[model samples]
Target: MVRIAYDPTPYHFNHGVLELPDIVARLGYEYMQLTPHPEFGPFHRMPKADDELVAALKKRAADAGVKIVALQPVQRISWPEEPQREAAVRNFKRVIEITAQLGVDTINTEFSGRPERSEDSEAGFYRSMEELIPVAEKEGVRINIDPHPDDFVEDGLEAWRVIRGLNSKQVGFVYVGSHSFHMGNQAATLLPQVGDRLGAVFAADTYDHHRSNGLRYITNPPGNSVRVHQHQEIGNGDVDWNELFDTLGKIGYLDREDAVIVSNVFGENEDAEGSALRQLDKIRELISGAAR
Candidate 1:
């Protein structure tokens, strides 16, 4: 069955990394996706988690009856600069080791490149992949990439094509619902192309900034590039939930064992508890509706 996981980012400010499993269980989720955290793995740096911390975190999650579905670490693996790319490769290898130690098999991360230097950044990505793909394969871990806004490749299909270029079964793609607009709002087409290689879907909502003749958001400088999106609760934004789920079901992602749907609302942390519960309820409702 497709697993529903929780991204504990809203609670990161208050909760320690080791305490995340209990927090997720309290929110009525059976699985958790560990995002960047200071004690575990911070963004754009080496992982801070030692072996002792890894063992303790594993025990904590087990005791809480919460399974870890994936680990998310944002590294400059696609950096155009050679030094950062090489360091990211080394850190990525260590992340695989940490992932294996925790008994997890999935790592989802961003491309971490610049739009102005896409070609160079893409080359760096390939070089880093050449070194780390073997390590991930040996460790039995799959790496999924999210083409985040402002990165080298923000379009959904293009990102998939870039990932496909790697020619490795272990590399996959992540489709984020909240980024629907920035990615050209083509889930119907993109998800089909992703097919079984689609590793995870992030559940959040955002308004389409491309609407109203590009006046949905008015930048101060009038045409300066700025990525606009939000992590609102499911129904609050413009994401076509039914259509997304239908496409997912059509592509067989709804029934796949390795497929994960993550709740990653970030805009409303003051009422995070309620938002998380609502998101879980809504995800189940959509999944149920899709199944029928």
Candidate 2:
């Protein structure tokens, strides 16, 4: 059976960990992919949370019957300089430890560009991977690097190359269709290879060319730009879902099972919760139809 998962980034402002499972369960998604933005707010970070607290959170979700597909930790390990870079690495390790305690195997993150020379940036990337890879292995977790348009590694090809260079099975790609569409309309050609390094998939929409940088840019209020133009819902954009879904299926995505997809619905702070629910409902319908 295909497992459907939701990324909580869309409605994160309106909800918290405590209320997430219920909302997710209510929407009919089997798994919930938590986008743990450390700086987002107090409720989402849980930095000082111990095993007992972590277990409680997991128990709450389980009690609600919403499994954790993965934890998407953004900017958890992205830094421009060495000192800040080290700090980012430490934060990332903490997140890995949390995932380990929570019984989650996938930790999704990104590598922001280094403002150094090209060769220096390449060197820093490998160095960063080497630094972070062992923590993932030690924790028995897969490090998912989802490509963002503004990041150093934004497209499928570069991500593949980085993973190959790292040469560890612990690293994989979280194929974000919006970024793929904006960076290059290559998800179709990339899907086959995507399966090979597949860690997760974030189902989102974007325009033909604007700010599809994987960072949702809410030109509206709440001032979040991780992804561009949070739009109202899926299938309301120019992204070719049919072909993308078909290609994903061919690559063994299996509708909602092979990967976890999250919807990035843009809206004002007051309308956030409704937008997320709306996106979730629409996606459930879309995936259901696609599966058929």
Please report, in order, the local distance difference test score of every candidate based on alpha carbons.
0.94, 0.66
lDDT of 1 by residue, 132-200 (tens): 999999999999999999999999999999999999999999999989998989998998989889999
Global CA lDDT computed for model 2: 0.66
> Mind giving the per-residue lDDT tens digits that candidate 2 earns over 89-153?
66677778888888888877666654234345556667777888898899999987866665665
Best by TM-score: 1
TM-score of each: 0.98, 0.81
Q: At residue 286, give the lDDT of candidate 2.
A: 60
Clashing pairs in 1: none
Task: List clash counts for every candidate, in order.
Answer: 0, 13
